[model samples]
Target: MHRCTLSKEKLAAQPGGEWTHSVSAGFLKTLGCLELLSVVGLILPAVLDIAPVMVPVTAVCWVLLLTGAMITRGRLGQVKLVAGDAAYFAIAVFVAYGRFVIEPFSS
Candidate 1:
């Protein structure tokens, strides 16, 4: 018995086709959104200090997003991207943890 394999041609032709488009678009959008949120969360809180809560919230979200990114990239079968993404993700998590635990919020 032989298992079905996706060919480069098949994968490429329909990439951004039906389900592919939606899933890819959603994931990419989510990634971009998370980065933006992370920045806004870290900076806005430190500068505005409005809620001062935004920092932790954003940091957590960043770590979460990176987790998703790492998973998605892994499933998508991109090794180089996965490695880079995971490394960055680790950094993000560390920063988040640092903000929440170590540095925390200060007046």
Candidate 2:
């Protein structure tokens, strides 16, 4: 939610939105939307028991998003910026695997 709010503020052309400065406003907004939706998917479907399959799928999507962010940060030579994304990627991967195999949500 923190990240999504910041990206949304960037859409308003506000200052201090450096987190998304590397990308265009439209791209940032789209990414924010995806992130927000994934957040919803992470919680709502499982809680509601409706299409609970979405939780792991959303985790996979987050893994992909974090992978892209890490690659982009690498290309920019921003080694320091890569850590967060890498950490997020690890967690997302774990969620994907755990949810799919160990404790998948039931419909």
Candidate 3:
């Protein structure tokens, strides 16, 4: 009987944090997916054989956006998730460099 009440309390306490994390992470994950597609589809094509400045500009914007996300998570005491945004920022920078300069010069 006592165990049942303890289990119930534990279950009740979980949704509050889990749901909040799920919602926030879900939002960021979806946006990250879009950004990924943009990097490959839009930025890469632009940098490879077309207008070049937009790709770097987009990369800068992406890094700034992720920084803002990290700041928000910090304000919410969710610093553990900041690593994901940091990775995204790094990938964006890498994509910018690889597409705009490295690939063009190597080939």
* Top-TM-score structure, candidate number: 2
Q: List candidate 2 segments past 4 Å from native.
A: 1-22
Whole-model Cα lDDT of every candidate shown, in order: 0.63, 0.77, 0.59
> How does residue 46 of candidate 3 score in lDDT?
63
Clashing pairs in 1: none
As for model 3, its CA RMSD to the true structure in angstroms is 10.5
Q: Can you rank all candidates by lDDT, best first? A: 2, 1, 3
**Segments in model 3 whose C-alpha atoms lie over 4 Å from true places:** 1-44, 97-107
Ranking by TM-score: 2, 1, 3
TM-scores of all models? 0.64, 0.78, 0.49
Tell me the number of clashing residue pairs for each predicted model: 0, 0, 0
Candidate 3 has an lDDT of 0.59
* Candidate 2 lDDT for residue 15: 33
Residue range 41-103, candidate 3, lDDT tens digits: 545646576555566657767877778777766676766667777888898788668757777
Ranking 1 against 3 by lDDT, winner: 1
